[model samples]
Target: MRSKVSIQKLTMSYYLKDRVVTALNGIDLEIADGEFLVVVGLSGCGKTTLLNILAGFIKPTGGEILLDGKPIAQAGLMNRGVVFQEYALFPWRTALQNVEFGLEMKGVDRKNRREIALKYLDLVHLTNFTNIYPHHLSGGMKQRVAVARAYAYEPEFMLMDEPFGALDAQTRESLQALTVEVWQKTRKTIFYVTHNIGEAVYLADRIIVLAGQPGRIYKEIRVDLPRPRDSFDPRYVELERETTRAVRQG
Candidate 1:
């Protein structure tokens, strides 16, 4: 697998009040093309910061991120799609319309974008709810729409920041499965940040734990288990325990 996204000696800092605060320091990582990479850590671990940099929402104070050997900043917003913990869907738009928003921004024709949007909504198993508004949908349904929206434009990378954090246990698990299904089908390189160890173990090809007080990668673990992982399986349980211990130690 070739490296699709590379973080080289990355650093970020800022001032709060009268003192300087470093959010990240000396970080280096490489994400392979179509790899599902999850970042786990405690609060203030710069996980969101790192994702923000990749999304081009913020520039790192030092170092750089490379996408396909080119500066990630140059990749443009169209190449990197982000899904937030909050289902940032438009209240005014129906599920299909929300999914079409990105394509519309990209100048895709109305009829083509609508067809594309419906296809992705169907991909998320929301074919029957395409005309529903966000406020009318359940939390999980809204999130499904958000995911569909992000993928509709066919971005090379998907940056997810705790997208399932707000859902209940059952909903979260279902969304996790849905996410894996989407990843397997689309093969999009994904960077998912979450505090849930089980979620990380279930979804990641690899996991990186970040430590705080100037966050940096503390440990990297690869999940060798087969797909559609069973949480009750002994190996799965042990791996989850191991990842939890790593996060605690971090």
Candidate 2:
């Protein structure tokens, strides 16, 4: 697969009081085009930091990022879409309007934006809730809106930070299936961060594990399980166990 994004010796650090906290250290990675990549580890492993840098929300303290062979100095919504665990929907905007928000910002005409938003709402199976507000929707429904909003913008890649973390077990599983369905249809390169080893194994074509305290890549595991993986299958169980052990060791 062709490289969509490349990181070379990536490092990040921040200062607090008289001390410095290193978030990432000498991280090198290559994300393939249309690949589903998941980053997993314990808290403070710089998973979110990596996702933030990839989204161009924060500049690395060292190293550089290349997007499609070009240096990415602060890419905005045009090139990347972010879906946070919090959903980040506008309370004032209806679900349809929330999905249309990015298109509106990009100056997409009303008719086109509405059409695109509706298409993605259908993709996430949320078409019936398009007129509802965030406060009126369930947690999973709100995340679906968030996913639709991200997809409506038509970005080449999606940066997801534990998007299903807040949901109940059943809802999370359902959303995971929805996310895979959307990914299969869109084929967008996805970089997702999560602490759930099972979820990562279930969703990713590849997994990168980060170790904490100036986090760095600890392991890279390629999951070759057949799509629509069975969580109860022995192979899936084995991989999940290995991934969990790697995270624990990290």
Candidate 3:
């Protein structure tokens, strides 16, 4: 598979108050172009730190991250888009404005940005609430808006940090289905960090399990449950159980 993003001996540490605490220890990962890779681990397992480094949101203490064979020097709009665990929608901006914000930053004119934003909103089935404020939207609706915002940006890769972690089970399932549809349609490479074993099994092309105090990749499992998966299927349950054990025992 072609690598869209590659990490070489990636390491991260925080020198907080002159104490060196390693967050990532000699890690390497490659996310293929148009692949959906889900990562599962216990809390504080450095999954979020890994995504942050890939996004250039946090500089790694050691090693490097490359996007499309080039070094990721800094945060740039062209590089990637991130969906937060918490829907980081701007409260003051309506759904449409929030989606258009990225285009505006890219210097796309008002006429074009609005057109693109609405198109994304429609794609996420949120066209009816384009004018709604973040506060007026439910948790699931807010997350859908955030997903639309990322799509509107037309990023080459997406880093999702448990985008559906805060939602109810039903909402999470719907969003997972919606995300798979978008991923198939756009072929955007995604590195999603989550703790949900079933969600990882249902969404990922491959699942990476991280373990240890300073997280390291424990196992890489290719999910062969097939697309449009049914969680009730025996194959799905089997893979989920295997992954869960790898994570717990790693």
Candidate 4:
């Protein structure tokens, strides 16, 4: 796989009152095209911050980011789609309309937007709920809508910040499966940040662990297990244990 995004000496810091806080320090990494890469670490380890920078939600204080070898100089959502843990859907819009929001912003015509939105809603198995608003859906269903909305844009990179973190175990697992389904279908590059080591191991092609207060890559673990992996399977368990150990000991 070719390198889809590159980060060199990435650093970030900000002032809160009289103190300067460092979020990331001297970070260096590369994300492959069509790869599912997950970042894991303890809280305040800058996992979310890194994802935010990648999503162009924040400007790094130092270093540079390159997308397809070109410097990313501004915050924009052209080819990047983000799924937040909060299920950041429009409360006023129906499921189909929320999915169509991005396309609308991109100036896609109403007719084509509806067609594309419905297709993605079906992909997430929410076609039947397309007419309902966010308040009418369950947490898992709302998240499925968010996932569908993210995929509707056909983004080059899908940036997720603990997207399933807020759901229950069963729902989280279901959405995890749904996420893999979407990724398999679209083959989009995914950069996800999560504190759940199990989720990271289960979903990632490669896992990057960040350590220390000013976060930096401590270890990189690759998952070689077959897809539709069983958590109880020997190889899967081994990798998950290894990843968990890395997090605890990092």
Candidate 5:
């Protein structure tokens, strides 16, 4: 697969009162087109920081990110979509309207945008809840709406930061499967950050472990297990153990 995004010698730091704290140092990575890549580490490892830089939410103090060989800062385009742990849905808007938000921003006509929004809602199995408001939806339902909203705009890269972290165990597992299903269909390059080893094992085509406190890549592990991945399978169990050990040791 072609490299869709590239990171070279990335570094980030910020002042916390009188001290300048480094969040990431000399980090480098490449995400392939249509690949599911997950970043895992202990807290303070800069996983979210890296994802934010890729989403164009923050500029790294040093180095640069490239989208298809062009500097992301110079690209002048909204080519990345992001999903967060919190269901960042509009409380006032119904599910359908919320999904329509990005399309509306893109200057899509009302009728056409509605059609596109509905299609994405259906993709996320939220067609039945189209008119439901965020306040009325359960946590999982709210996240499904968020996922639909992100996909509706057809972005080249999807940046996810612990999107399933807030949910119950069963709900998290359900959404994990839903995420893979959506990815298989859309084939969008996904840059996901999580501390959950099982989640990383299940979702990632490749996993990069970051060491904490001035985060740097400590290890890279590729998952060779077949999908519809069985977590209970021995190979799956072994890989999960290996990843857990890497995270602990890193």
Candidate 6:
């Protein structure tokens, strides 16, 4: 069977005036269905750029990205869902309304949309905040709403670009646990991007480290540790160290 997502010899470059800057250099990867994969790299390492190519937001100058043996041409709702570092919740919309926005776009009816959206809201433990606006919610709450919105649509895959980066350390850890719980319950395939090695190790089924000026796979580490992983575990620390060494080496 084909993988859920596949990248073959993926390359991207941006034209900065007359000089072309290479953002990615020959990236190849495959994500199995329901796999939680994390990518770590320093700033300017093309981690986010790589995700954009997979999500069809940025076209690669070289190579093709395939899903189920077919090349993806442009962005669409059927294949992928994306979340940003900053929670892009609509301030005017209440928590429930923000989640229901995606269903509204899909033409899901009012009654059905409310029912489905509520189920996901409850999954993220945000039922009480349903009637509250984005501004009324805390930073972590907004991200929870964002997660609910993304998952409520029930897309085949998720692309997260540092969704937890903006939160405090304690809040980040709490949300990470929440994310794991939701994933275990829902089995959603996620391509999560982060600079934190510990975050990657704690959440990922596999970790891919990107490195160098022209980003490439510096190291790919398979996390054999079983879930639900603890941040305090020695094995978790070891995995983070291995990925860290790969980054330094690259």
Candidate with best TM-score:
1
Residue 204 in model 6: lDDT? 93
What lDDT would each prediction earn against the true structure? 0.94, 0.93, 0.91, 0.91, 0.93, 0.90
Instruction: Give a tens-digit lDDT track for model 6, residues 1-250.
Output: 5688888898899999889999999998998989999999998999999988878887899987777667877436457778888999999999999999999988999999999999999999998889999998999999999999999889888989999999999999999999999999989889999999889999999999999589999888999888788767898888888988887888
Which candidate ranks first by lDDT, i.e. highest? Answer: 1
Clashing pairs in 2: none
Over 72-112, each residue of candidate 5 has an lDDT whose tens digit, in order, gives 98765458889999998988999999999999988999999
TM-score of 4: 0.97
Report the candidate with higher TM-score, 5 versus 6: 5
Report clash pairs, candidate 4.
none
Candidate 5 regions with alpha-carbon error over 4 angstroms: none
lDDT against true structure, model 6: 0.90
Q: Give the root-mean-square deviation of each candidate in angstroms.
A: 0.8, 1.0, 1.2, 1.1, 1.0, 1.2
Q: Against the hidden reference, what TM-scores do the models get?
A: 0.98, 0.98, 0.96, 0.97, 0.98, 0.97
Model 3, range 1-250, lDDT digits (tens) per residue? 6688888898899889968778889898888899899999999889998988888788898987888888887536466889997888999999999999999988899999999999999988998999999999999999999999988889999989999999999999999999998898889999999999999999999999999678899999999877899988998999989998999898
Q: Please, what are the lDDT tens digits per residue for candidate 1 over residues 1-250?
A: 6689999999999877899889999999999999999999999999999999899998999998899889988888899889999998989999999999999999999999989999999999999999998999999999999999999999999999999999999999999999999999999999999999999999999999999979999999999999999999998998899899988998
Minimum summed lDDT over a 10-residue window in model 4 is located at: 69-78
RMSD of 1: 0.8
Name every residue pair that clashes in candidate 6: none
What TM-score does candidate 5 get on C-alpha atoms? 0.98
Alpha-carbon shift of residue 12 in model 6 (angstroms)? 0.3
Segments in model 2 whose C-alpha atoms lie over 4 Å from true places: none
